[model samples]
Target: MQGNKSEHTIQKEIQLALSKHKCSVFRTNVGKVKTIDHRWFDTGLPQGFPDLMGYRWVDNQIFFIEVKSQTGKSRPDQLIFHEFLQSHNVIHGIARNVKDALMIVDGGLCGFGYD
Candidate 1:
């Protein structure tokens, strides 16, 4: 199923599913933009920020998802960011399909217990 869809499509599907489940989701666009003066500025997020972010009310948890196509690979900065999230006990993952994304948001994987 993942082999055919673009990342954007998968992301939309995931967002819809999450919304149906009463979770708040958002898309993150990361890149640099050139100003009229020909100066480049980042989109303000740290490099490698996840493609989506949201909060799951049931668990009172926040999650992040990096959407990718079947043949897509994360860049080094993204890998670093994922590692950082893990170390900080943040909920995050790479999702190639809606199922993967839902799993991450549902805390089926990449979830840490809080006291």
Candidate 2:
């Protein structure tokens, strides 16, 4: 348990660092400030995806994450989608664990905390 906790903390740190770096470089390239937070999709199908979505401007790609501070707190639809992504070996997210979800985005495939 202690080991897991330590590892989680380390992961969190790396994620934060990478996110900050990515955001900084991204903003510079766009020549704009103020990163928009959270883009939602309203499927109007009883439930929807929203926790967060990022648009990779250069590549015209999208990345999604569900994001829950606690694993069990995830919405049903999110759970379903999560499983689907896993099974298909596709990329999607449980959103985030906090206001700032640390993830390294590369080639439309995101690394869960840089490793």
Candidate 3:
């Protein structure tokens, strides 16, 4: 089930699960935006930012998730960014499926604190 899912599908499933868990999450589109005149402009976020960002109300904790397919590998920039987030004591992870994402947000698998 995980290996065949697309990143988009995984993201949607994660979003839905998070919503049900009472977390406020949104997808982050980090790329060039096309204008009506055929112009392209940056979205202003640094490259390799996570795919989803949100806050959990229970603890008022913020989280960032980089959704990927089961076989998807993060780019070098994404790894660097994740390291940066870790250095800052942030909650962030690369989630390949809804379960991974839930674990990340719940602080269960990425060494963020939840036991």
**Winner by TM-score:** 3
Q: Write the per-residue lDDT of candidate 3 for residues 1-115, one digit (tens) a residue.
A: 6589899998999999999998999998898988999999999999989899999989878999988887787888887778788878888888877878888888733423211
* lDDT (Cα, 0-100) at 52 in candidate 2: 43
lDDT of each: 0.82, 0.42, 0.82
Model 2, stretches more than 4 Å misplaced?
Answer: 1-48, 70-72, 86-90, 95-104, 107-115
Query: Which candidate tops lDDT?
Result: 3
lDDT, residue 76, candidate 2: 60
User: Which residue pairs does candidate 1 place in steric collision?
Assistant: none
- TM-score head-to-head 1 vs 2, winner: 1
Per residue, candidate 2 scores C-alpha lDDT tens digits across 36-85 of: 67564443432434344455445545555544443335656556655655
- TM-score against truth, every candidate: 0.87, 0.40, 0.89
Question: Considering TM-score, where higher is better, how would the candidates rank from best to worst?
Answer: 3, 1, 2
What is candidate 3's CA lDDT for residue 60? Answer: 78
lDDT score of model 3?
Answer: 0.82
Better of 1 and 3 by TM-score: 3
Q: How many residue pairs clash (N, CA or C atoms closer than 3 angstroms) in each of the candidate models, in the order given?
A: 0, 7, 0
